[model samples]
Target: MHHHAFSRRSAGIHSLPVELLTRIFVLGSQFEYLYEDSPFLLKPVQDYSPAEAPNLQVIVSHVCRHWRQVALRTPSLWTTLHFRKISHIQRATMYLSRCSLSGTSNTYLLDILIDTVAEEDYLPGINLYKNELRTIFQAIVPHVRRWRAFHLKICDDDCKAQARQYLSACGPAPSLETLQLYHFTDYRTAQRLYLATYRPPVIVFSNTLPRLKNVSLIGVNLPWDKSPFLQDLHHLELALHLDNIRTPYAYWDRMLRLSPELRTLCLHYSGPKEATAADPALIWPNLDDKIQLRSLQELSVTDLDPDYLCQVIQRLHIPNVNKLTLDLPDQNFTPFVELLTNSAATGSTDNTGRASNTQASSRFHPMEHSSPSTTPPDSPILSLRNLETLIVRALECSPSSLISLLRATQALRVLQVDFSRVGGGLCQIFNQDPGITPSAASLASTGFVHHPLLPLLKIMKVAGTPGKDILNTLHTRHRLSREPPAVSEKWIIGWDEKRRGTDAELDALVDKGYWSFTGQGRKVRVIIETYDDEEEVEEVPDNDAESGDDDELEDEP
Candidate 1:
C-alpha cells in the first residue's frame, strides 16, 4: 500500500555530544532570530545595525548546529523589539513569540515604540499611522498579563483618548511593575481610573501594590489634590509641565506620606510663569514638619528657583542620601547650593569607604584653576565637605571674586566653570563693584572666600573667552606651588576667540622673580616685564620751554 515517507533528521543532531548539546542550548538560547537575515526583521547594512546589536547571537549560530539551536532559545536576547512601522509590528511579534516566557511562567519585558514625537509632527506621516495605535493596543490589551512594560505615544487626540480609555478600562496592572506615560493627551482617563472606584480622605492605596516598583510621569501633571495611586514603589520619577500655573505645595506633601521603601525620587517644579507665579512650598501649611523622606535615599533636581530648591533640601532628612547635584541658577546663588548639601546628615551618617568617598567627590568646584587668577565658589555656602563630584557650569565671574571662592573650599577636588555664563549685562557688573552684584552679593558667605583651602583639589575645568585670564592665573599658582601641572599642555589661552575679552587690556601680575603671565588668556598672553602703562614726562623738555618764555618776557619788558 503505499510509499512510506522518510523524514531526514539533522545528521549529527541525534548523536550530538553532551558538551556540544550544552553549547548548542546556550547558543540557541542566546541567539535572537530578529538579529538574523529574515524578511521579518531586516536591518540596513551599516556601521550601526541591529544585526550587530546581536553580534554574539549571529556568530554563535554559525559555530555549529547545536549552537544555532541554543542561540535560538534565549529569551533575553529576543526580548526587545524596535517596531519602526505598522508593518513591522506583526513580524516583530511573531519573532517575540519564540521567546515567550510561558516556560518560565513569567511575563516577557519589551520596549515598544509606536510613533516618535518628531514623526508625529509631520502631517502625512501621522495620518498614515494614526489608525494603527488603536489596532495595536487592541491586540496587546487582551494579553495584559504578559505586558511587562508598554509605552504608546499617539499625537491625534482621538487616538490618544482611545488608547487611554482602553488602558484605564484594563483595570489595575498586577504584573505590571513599570509604567511610563509620555505625551498623554487626556490625563482625566488616569484621574478617573485611580479615583472613580475609590473616594478619599485621599489615602489612595490600601494593601495596594506588591509588585509595582517603578513609575515615571513625564510631561504629565497630577492634580495638586490627587494622591499617588501606586503604593510601595521602589523608585518614582516625576517630570511636570506645570503650565506656569502654580499648584498647592500640599500636592507634593502627599507624596511624602507613602511607605518609606522609596529609594529614588526625581521631582521637578514646572508650571507656566503665569501673569504672576506663586511659590507652592511657601504657601503649604502642612509642610512645617513633614521633612522626613523615610526610605528615600537619592534626590535629583533641575531648572528650579534657588529659594524653593533650598526649602526642599532643608525639609527632607534623607539619611541615605550621599550623592547631590546642583545645576546652579544663573543668579549664582551659593546659599541655595548650601541648602542641598545640608541634606547629607554627616557624623550621624557613616558613608565611609565607597559611600564616604562618594560623599567626598560631591563637593564644590572652583570656576577656573588654570587661569593666572583663580575664581571659585564659596564652599561654606554649599557646606558639602563630604561631596564627591562638583560640576560647575558656565560661570562669568570677576577674577578677584572667583579666587576668593576657590580659597574658601576645604575639600574641593574637581572644579569646572564655563565663562559663557557671563551674561551681556556684564557691563552692569563692573560698573558696580562686581562683588556686590546680585549672585555674588547675597550668598550667605560673600564671594570673598575665607578658608584654609582645599588640600585635595584636583581636576580643574574652565572654558569660554573670559576663562583665559582666570586660567593663566591658575597656572601661575600651580607653577609656584609646583602644583604638578594638572592642566593640559595644549590649553592655549585664546581657545575661545568669539567673545574677544575686554576693551581695557589686562594689567601685569608680578611674582617673586618670574614675570607673571597676565592679560586675558584668550588673546595674546601679553607677557609683561613690568607694570608701567604710563611714561614719566621728561623734566628737560619742560625746563627748556620755561627758560625761553622767561627770556622772551624780559625782552618785551
Candidate 2:
C-alpha cells in the first residue's frame, strides 16, 4: 500500500516541456562515427552487421507515444541523412517529410551523405545496383536547392553519369557551403571506360555554389575554368592525375589569386593504377608570375612529381605560414631540402632581391632529365621566417641535409621525423657527424667555430631506433632544465618490433628510463626447461630514486 502511494505521488518524465525534451533528444543522438573531416569509403552491409534498425527516428519515436510526437516535430534532428545501404530510401523519404515545418515550406537546410556501393545482402546483379542508385538519386534531386553540405562516395562510371545528369538538372545552390565528391575505383577501370567512350565524365556546376568555402574533389573530373566553384574557398583538397586535367596548374594559380583568404591547401597526385603505353608524357606548367598567400597557415604536398613540386614551392610567396608537411619520394628530397634550408635561414629575402632572373629560373627549373642533387648553385634564397612546425613522412632524408635544415629554422619549436620508410639504420647516419652533434649544436653558441641550431626547439617526436648520441642529447636537455627553470620537455620515440632483436643500445636506453616503450610489444613464448621462449618480457619502470635522477644533474650557470 505504501509503494503504490509513492508511485501515484511521483511525476513522470513525459510531463517535461516539449522544448526541453527536443534538446534532450538531440543530445542523445550524438553517436560515434568514423567519417570525421576525412574521406571514407563505405563498406558492404555485411561489414555493418548486427544492423542498426532501418530508421533511428522511428526507433526513438516508438519508445512512447509522447516521444513519437516530440521526435516527429523536431526538424533539426532530421536535417542530416546518411544512407549506408541502397534500400534505405524508405527511411530517407520519411526524414524528408519530417524535416519540413509545414505542408509546403521546406525551411531547414539539409546535409546529405550518401555511399552508393552494393552490399552482400543485396541481390547479386550489376543492373540491380544501378537501378537502386537511380531511384534513390532521383528522389533526392528535388531537394538539391536546400542542400548545405553534400558528400557523395560512389564507385562506378554509371553512377557518376547518373549523378552528373541530376546535378545538371538542379539550378543554383545558394545555400551550399561545403561539397565533397569522391570516386573510389582503380585507374584500370577508369581507363577502360575512357577508352570505350572517348570523353571523361565531367560535372560542371556553373555559377551554382557562391558561398562554398571548403571543397574536396578526389578522382572526380570537373570543368574547373567554366565554373564559379573555385571562388572564395578557404580550405581545398585535390587528388587527381595530371593527365586527367589539361591545365591543372593554371586552375591552381587562379584559385589562389581569387581566394586570398585561403588558409589550408592539400595537393596529392593520383596517378593511374597501372601504367599504359598511351599515357602522355608529363609537361611542366609554365609559372612566370609568383602567387602570394598572405593568410595561409598550413600546406601539404604528397606523391607529386619532384620537379613540379619544387617549381610550385619556388613560385609561391607565403610569409605567414606556420606549418608545412611533405611526403614525397627520397630522390626528390634534395631540391626541396635546399629550398627549405635557404627559406629558414636568416636574411634569405635580401639574397632573393640580389638574385638574377637567370639564376632564379635555373634554381626553379623543372629538372626534366637531371637528378635533384645536380641542381645549379645560383638558386635564389627564400625565407620562411614565420614557420614554427615541420613534419616529414616516408622519405629517406640524409643527416647532413636534415642538420642543415634545422640550423636554418631559428623559430621552429616542434619537430617530427618519421623513419619507418627508411631501409637502413637511422642512428648510423645521423651520429657520424660530430660537428652537428646534439650536445655541441646548442642554439646559444655564438663563436667562430661553433654555431647553434634549432634555437627554440622544445618538442622532438621521432619514430625509429636512433643512436646513443641521440639519447645522450635528450638526457643533457633534461639535465639543463633545473637552473634556467625551463618548462618540462617531452621526447617521444617509436620503434618497430623487429628492431628489438638488433637494437642493443635502444634496449639500454629503455632500461635507463630515458625512453619508454609505447608501441605494441611482440608476442613471445617462454619455458623453464626444454621449450621455446614465448612470453612478454616485463617492462622496466622509470626508476627516479635509484640513480641518474633529475635532481642529480648540476644546475646550469
Candidate 3:
C-alpha cells in the first residue's frame, strides 16, 4: 500500500507543466545513447514519428512556440536525415515537407552516421532507400554550394560513391566555405583499377576552393601534389609513414613551394620506410636553403633521432619555425644535448623574424675534462641562448652526469633532472675498474685548461638522490656557520687543521677565497666556522666534561 502511494505521488509530480519540466528533461541531450530494458518483452519499436522523434530538429521545437514554428519551418533540420530514421521515412518525409516548406531556395544539407559499412548489411538493409537518398544528395549537394559549411562523413566509400551518382541532378554549389571528408574509404580496388585512367589532377587544376583553409589527410594518398588547389590553407597535417623515398628533398620542396600561404605545417612520419629500396645511393637530399616560405611559422616533427634531424633542420633553414617538438626516442642523453648546440643563438631567423630566425652567437667550446666521456663524437651541436623551455623525458640523467651537461650550456633557464642516477655514480665506475678515475688526472698532468660554461645559468630542478657536494656546489649559495668564543683554543685548532694544507697552495687557495671542508668519520658532512673582521680563528666543538674527567684521572694517578 505504501509503495503504491509513493508511485502515485511520483507520477503526479512527473505530470508537472511542460514549461517547468523541460529544463529537467533536457538532461537527455547529454547522454550519447538510449537503451531498451530487456530481451524479455519485444522492445518498444520506436514509432519513428517525424514530429515526435527525439532529434536536434524536434528538440528545438520544444524551446518555445516561436521556436516551435521556426524550428518546424527550417528545411535544413529536416533535410539532414539520419540512417536510423529509415524505419519511419514515410512519416519523416511528411514532417520534412512541412519543415522545409520554405522551398529549395533556402537549400539544405543531409548527413548520416552508421555503425558498420559491410556490403552484406548495407546492400540488403539500405537498398530500399538508396535511390531516394542518392536523389536527395544530388539535389542538395549542387545547390548548397554557397553555404558556409557542408560536410558528409561516411565509413563505407561505396555508400558515398553510390550517393554521388545523382550529382547530375543538381547544379554547382558556390557558397560552401568548408568541406570535410574523414575516414574516407581506402578504395584500394578503385585506386589500382583507376590508376591508369586517373586524371584527377587535370580536373582539380581548374577547380579551385578559393576559400578552403584547412586540410587534414591521414593515411591518404596524393596522386599528384599539384592538385587540391587550396589557396588559403592556414594549417596542414599530412601524415607520412615509412616513406622509403630516399630523395624526398624535392617532394616537400615542391609541396611547400606550392603552399606559399600556409602558416602552420606539421609533418609526422612513422618510419624511415624507403620509397626506393633498390636505390642505396639515393641519399636523403638536402633542402634548398635559398627557398623562401613566406607565411610559414611553426614546424613539428616526430619519430626521428636528433643527429639526423638536426642535419635536416640545418639544411631546411626555415627562418619562421619558432616552436619545435622533438618526440624521438633518445636512449642516450648525448644526442639530445648535442642537438641543443644548434639552438638559434643570435641571427638565425626565417624571413618572417620568427623564433627559428635566431643565429649562432658563440663558438662550441669543448670541456677541458677530456675524461673518458660518455658523450659521442657525432652528437648534434646546439646553442641554448634562444631556447626558453626544454623538456627531457626518459631515464638517462644523474646529478654528476648532469653536472657535466649543465657546465656546457649558457641560455638554460629551466632544467629538470629525474631520478636516473640512483645506485650509480662516477665512483662506481672507478670501483668496477680503477682506470676510469684518472681522466681528471690526465687533464691535470697535460696542463690543459678548458673553461666549460658560464655561471650565468640558473634555475636547476633536480629529482632523485643527489650527492651533497654536487648539490651544494651547483645549487645553494655558501653561508658561514657560527661558533662559541675561545681565542687561544681557536688558534690551536686552526694550527692543527692548517698542518694538512701546504702553506703555498693553501695560501693561494685562501687568497682566492677558496671554500674548504672537513670530513667526519666515513660520512660526507662538512666542518664549518663563522668569519669576522677581528682576526682569523677556528673553534672546535665543546668537550669539557671529557677533559675534566681526564684531568681528575691524571691527578689520582
Give the lDDT ranking, best first: 2, 1, 3
Report lDDT (Cα) of residue 189, candidate 1. 62
Tens digits of per-residue lDDT, candidate 3, 246-349, equal 22434444445456677665555422222233443323332123234446655555555444444445434344443333434434434333334333332232
The clash count of every prediction, one per candidate, is 49, 7, 30
**lDDT score of residue 324 within candidate 2:** 77
Candidate lDDT values, in order: 0.41, 0.55, 0.37
Number of the top lDDT candidate: 2
lDDT of 1 by residue, 517-554 (tens): 21222222222222211223322112222221221222
lDDT of 3: 0.37
What are the RMSD figures for all models against the true structure?
A: 23.9, 14.2, 25.3
Regions more than 4 Å wrong, model 3: 1-58, 74-140, 143-206, 225-228, 240-251, 270-285, 288-298, 303-557
Worst 10 residues of 1 by lDDT: 347-356
User: How high is each candidate's TM-score?
Assistant: 0.54, 0.68, 0.41
